[model samples]
Target: MERLQKILAGAGVASRRKCEELIQSGRVQVNGETVTELGTKADPAADVITVDGKTVGAQKKMYIVFNKPKGVITSASDPQGRKIVTDYLKGINERLYPVGRLDYDTEGLLLLTNDGEFAHLLTHPKHHVAKTYLATVKGVPHGTALDKLKNGIMLEDGMTAPAEVEYYDIDPEEKHATISITIYEGRNRQVRRMFEAIQHPVTKLKRISFGDLYLGNLKRGLYRHLTKEEVEGLIKLARTAGKPGNRPTPKKDK
Candidate 1:
């Protein structure tokens, strides 16, 4: 028997965490019985499971990389009537959700997948998946600003983890200078906040890479599935990081 949340996530029901919430809210039924427990288990090969009275089973897994455009929320829906990332995935039959998130104004590479276990591993704080971004700030930062970001900076939540920063020398004649930043943490508005702390507000931010994945020439709002090698490498990394018995934490929106 496996945890119900993991099974649901693997089955493309939702992320493991969100599945747990469904259970708690009395939306999930297992073997014809409502299961409201957080760590409930079920046999995927045998037991019948349902969410909101709909049968639940593993669906075809999909791994898509999207070059997200600015102004789209990284969510399945928005009650405020705003456009969400799902709007860009018009033809996909599988119900996939974004792995982590990009702020509404930020744009670039975003992963969408129905493989909840993989999503958990990629987004979990302990795994430390590095994300690289190209940022254009209002003013060019000096050595001190860069050093502060590398060491750590104080935020409202607490001190942030150290980040990797490098200047991007594009055209010297360009009005705005570009900088590359790599961070392991995924705190809300982290990249922007870090620069703001040093008096250099970010004008534009685009994530160029996430973990081993790169945004290779994909234009804005386009998406593609991850290559087999990339998927395997991610699986290996998750296993190496000790993801214990395939039991994933319940999914919550990041």
Candidate 2:
């Protein structure tokens, strides 16, 4: 049996994650019964599956990298009717969804795809691919502050994993700085909130890289298909990340 979302993704409905939303929203029917749980599964060969009353069929997978512009919602659609990431994908025929999300005001690299397994591989917790960002903040961080940020900062949600933080530029007045940070986790508003925890709220934030993929001169609000090499590199990185860690050390001598 295949997972409901996986089956939908392969049928070109959307990415696996987006398919989960369909399930949760009570729009997915399997053999004429609604399945709302994420773990629901069925044999696509036998089960008559439909999404929002439309039957699904095998479809080609698609991938692209979007240079998301500020003020656009990262979601496929917004209840408020604000422009969303999907609005920018007017010319693309296949249904695709953002791999992860960038905040409405945050600008930079965003990945979109209809490949469910590929999306799962990239966003899985064990495959927390490093993401690099450039952030303009309100104050220059002292060594102590920078150290705390690098080691880990305690946020209301939890302790952040270790990160790499450095000053990219500091104003002569020492009042503001452009900081570069690389982090593995992609919690909601994490970078902005991390700085806020350190008393240097971010004024501007832009992701420059995601694993092997780079924003690289893509004009704002425009997108491009990823090169074959870049896609291969991400698969390689995810494979490496998903490997089991070396077994725990043998019990030490007493």
Candidate 3:
């Protein structure tokens, strides 16, 4: 299910914000019941939605979980015509776009959806929906350095919000450390930048999870439709994030 304004907006009835105004003014109805609340959710395909006595056309909301391969730009299109994420979604009929983005050379879990509200909620910093990444770095940062990273780091942009940063594995012989990082903000190259500020550069990076979505056994360059339960799990998280005084906390490992 999706927001009523999104349904009406997708049907070419009006802009999404205008649809909300229509809902507040009692000009919209769902299955014969007037819905004036802005947060009310409904499935456009299952419900008979109307705006100002006009029927809103049916549109299916689509979601995809993709193991984005390296060297693909996470965007709808690239000006230089380089390979893009949509190239991997060739057969998809819906105009699904990436929820946030992964850098061109970064790989791992990425979400694609046609729902604007869902995308906005997930990516917005105020919502504080955390995204996770696994990074291989050169040196093992210990003691106060780890504490500095966990509390907050001073990047060129400014001080970042506190992150759940830890070393899941460290190979002293190989001089390589595998770090698991959970961050609430989506700053540009924030993960790599965080490590850099601590004097441990990120060698390779992959997003392992976004909100409740995980990569699991999905291999690289692969894509799949999110299961019903997975979708509902995200919706529930969004509801919680919407509450006043909701703050981003370090999520416990599952």
Q: Evaluated with TM-score, which candidate comes out highest?
A: 1
Write model 3 residue lDDT over 49-97, tens digit each, in one string. 8877888775577789999988999988899999888888878877777
Decoy 3 TM-score against native: 0.75
Error of 3 at 146 (Å): 1.6
TM-score of each: 0.89, 0.83, 0.75
lDDT of 1 by residue, 8-116 (tens): 8899888888877888999999888999988888999899999989998768888999999999999999999998998999799888899999999999999999998
Off by over 4 Å in 3: 1-57, 242-254
The residue ranges of model 1 lying beyond 4 angstroms of the native Cα positions read 170-175, 239-254
Off by over 4 Å in 2: 1-4, 15-48, 242-254
Better of 1 and 3 by TM-score: 1
| lDDT for 228 (candidate 1) | 89
Q: How should the candidates be ordered by TM-score, best one leading? A: 1, 2, 3
- In candidate 3 the C-alpha lDDT for residue 88 amounts to 88
